[model samples]
Target: MYEFVTGPLAWIAFGIFIIGMTVKVISVIRLASKKDKVVFNHWSWGWSFRSVYRWLIPFGSRSMREKPVLTIVFFVFHVCLLAVPIFLLGHNILWDERWGITWWSFSETSADYLTLLLMAAAIVLILRRIVLPEVRIVTTAYDYLLLAIAVAPFVTGYFAYHQWFDYKTVLIIHILCGEIMLIAIPFTKLSHMILFFFTRAHIGSEMGERRGAKTW
Candidate 1:
């Protein structure tokens, strides 16, 4: 069971993740190209690329000042979310063990703290959906499920690392949850992982060119 979970299952998950992302990206490009090739070429690609930094980082935009607390929470949340998995010592060690790819990584203690922060941020985002009237009105089971999908892997990983539960059980759950997240990204709203910058870039270019009468 361990061998299958650690080896073949991991490879299958990776394959699915790669194929799914490729299909999603190609579809987006096709749709946008079909909509209007002219709009894509009219803007300077360099400027659009440059604008990605400001759009991705909430602190870079003055509009984010309206919801300062939420802005800070999300900024920190995204940082930890993106960092913990890639930088965690366990994951890095596994990468080296499995593929002989060596890289520096955060110490175990640092990863623990970051993992905690990630879970906290997920909880906060969930509570915001439930507690905020405007947000709650639009909230659905699917929204909460997406948050669960985002949080489950880390929660299980933390337990697996700490031996909080049966190590094998928690570890298996961790791997499964991580695989589920990878596969879901290209299909669900989680596609935002890839789409976020592209959409932002398109908006930035359009607004920069005054293509629309007003800025968002």
Candidate 2:
């Protein structure tokens, strides 16, 4: 079981993640070319880059500034989300061993703190959806499910790292959770990881170039 999860299952997860995202990108490009041809006609690299850059920075946009607390939480959440996975020492070691790839990694202590922060942020987001009237109005079981799926790996990983339960079982669950997340990315709302840029670019170009108005 351990060997299968670490070997073939890992390969399958990565393959699906890569192929799924590639197809998603290609399909979006084709659809845009066909349906949003006019939007591309006036595409402005300047506006698109400006928009993406503005949003990338903490509190850089008007909406972000308006909700400073949420912005901070969101910024920290996303930063930790991306960082903990890629820069985790154990994960980096695995990459080095499996694919001859390695990069700077955070200390175990730092990774633990970041993982806790991420889970806290997820809890806050979940509460926001449930407690806020406006958010609650649109909240669905699906949204909650996605949030759980997104955070499961980190939760399991934290436990596995500390050997809170049976180390082998926790480790297997951690790996499976991580793979599930990768597989879910291209097909779910998590696609925003990539699509956010394209959507922001389109909006930016439309407003800035076509309307002579700023998007950010």
Return the top candidate by TM-score. 2
lDDT of 2 by residue, 88-126 (tens): 999989888888899999999989999999999998999
Write down the RMSD of candidate 2 (Cα, Å): 0.8
The per-model lDDT (C-alpha) reads 0.82, 0.93
Per-residue lDDT of 25-101 in model 1, one digit per residue for the tens? 99988988998686686565655665677757676776677788888889878888888888888888887888788
Error of 1 at 208 (Å): 0.3
Clash count, candidate 1:
0
User: In terms of TM-score, how similar is model 2 to the real structure?
Assistant: 0.98
Clashing pairs in 1: none
Query: What TM-score would each prediction reach against the true structure?
Result: 0.93, 0.98
- Pairs that collide in candidate 2 are none
lDDT, candidate 1, at 22: 87
